[model samples]
Every structure is written in structure tokens, then in C-alpha cells.
Target: MKNLKVNPSNSLKTSRLVIRIFASLITLFYLIAFVPKLIQMLLGDAPERPPGADWEGSMVTVSFLIFILGYIVTWWRGLVGGIIIAIGSILMFLTHMMSASGEFEFLPFFVFSGPMLLCGILYLVFWWKKP
Candidate 1:
């Protein structure tokens, strides 16, 4: 019987493509949904806050901007982008908790950041495994 050979590199390449596509899609979605609003916020056009929400809002905005920067950077530098995305994800959660105060909502935070976190980890893994 002839021996059938399996190429590990092909599988690795496939995984890399999969992760890249997922990351790209996530980035695209966020960019489309928020980029315009983010621009407005950054340009000092954001709607007025109630009273003491400025700090919390700024924290949340900065965290999201960090995540977006990571998304843009991932195309060029996977490892660095991954680190940034991970940091941003945690910051998003923490800032959210700070704003919530008494009633903490875990589901919303996880739902928003979980996919980004997963992609960041995958990016780091692929970068480390690269030959």
C-alpha cells in the first residue's frame, strides 16, 4: 500500500487564514458601526454627559480606540496587535464595571469583548508558531 502523507504546514496556513478572516471581519464590523461616531466624539462633538459621567465615558472611549488601533495594527504586526487588543479588552471590562457601580452586568461586557479576546489570543499563538 502506498503511504499517504499529511502536510502540517497546510493545516497551519489554513488556521492562520481563518484567524485573519475572523479578525478582519470583526474589525470591519466595528469600524463600520463606530468609526463615524468615534470621529465625532474625538472632534469634541459628542453629546453632553449627565454630570459625573465624563471620566467613565472617556475611559470607555479610550479603551475602544485602543481596540480599534489593535485591529488596524494586526495587519502589519500580529503579536503587538494581539497584546494591545487583550489590554483593551480588559480595560473595557474594568471601565464598564466602574461605571456600573452597584449593579454589575457581566454578560454585556463578555459578549462584546469575548470574540476580540479570542482573536487576539489566536493572533499571538500564530505569531509564536510561525517558522
Candidate 2:
């Protein structure tokens, strides 16, 4: 009889750790970003929205939900979480692109979406190589 031992590679371990940490941070960042608005709403001082801003606001809300879900799932399944985050990031990027008036408008989209895409890719890489 032969016995075999399976162990996770260091890269896999490191990647998993990184994914967990990054996912947590990403979730926290999104939640923190909403704190002001939440506070205002709770205090009955929510600012009035400009005309024709509802669609953009709704899109942002949906994307935020997707990111939250993706981060939550990352704790269990890295691949699924990565895909979800990637999808959310892509949707957000497209939304911003569609509404952009010029090159300057893409700055904010890139700033936010770039890290998200990177994190998503990192998670996928780790998931693919998981032992």
C-alpha cells in the first residue's frame, strides 16, 4: 500500500490570504463611502438629487450590492467571488464610460475600477491554482 500526502503550495496560501484581506478592505471601503449618505438620510438631512441623476444613482447602488455580495462569497469560494467582483467592476466601468463627457471623466472610473479588476484577477489566479 502507498500513502500520498497533499499540501497547499505557499503561493496558494499567500494568494488566499491576500484575497481575504483585499475582499474585506474592498467591502469596508464601499460601506465607508456610503456612511455620509446614510448618516444624512438617518438625520433627515439627505441632500436633494439633481434632475436626471436617478439612473446613475441606481446603477451605482446596484454595483455596490454586487461588490458586497462578491466579497461575502469570497470567504467560501474564491472563483465565484472573483467572477462576481469582476462583473460588478465591469458594469461600473461601463456605466461610468457611458456617462463620461470626455477623457477627463474616465479618471474616477479608472481610479476605482482599476484596483477592483486587479483584485478580481488575483482571486481568479489563486482559485485556479488552489491546492
Question: Any runs in candidate 2 off by more than 4 Å, and if so which?
Answer: 1-8, 48-53, 100-104
What does candidate 1 score on TM? 0.77
lDDT of 2 by residue, 13-127 (tens): 8768877887678778878876677677678787765323577667777777887787788788889988998998887787787764644376757666766777788888888
Cα error, candidate 1, residue 30 (Å): 1.7
Instruction: Tell me the whole-model lDDT of each prediction, alpha carbons only.
Output: 0.78, 0.75
Q: Candidate 1's residue-wise lDDT over 13-36, tens digit each?
A: 898899989987877876786667
Query: Each model's TM-score?
Result: 0.77, 0.80
lDDT of 2 at 96: 80
TM accuracy, model 2: 0.80
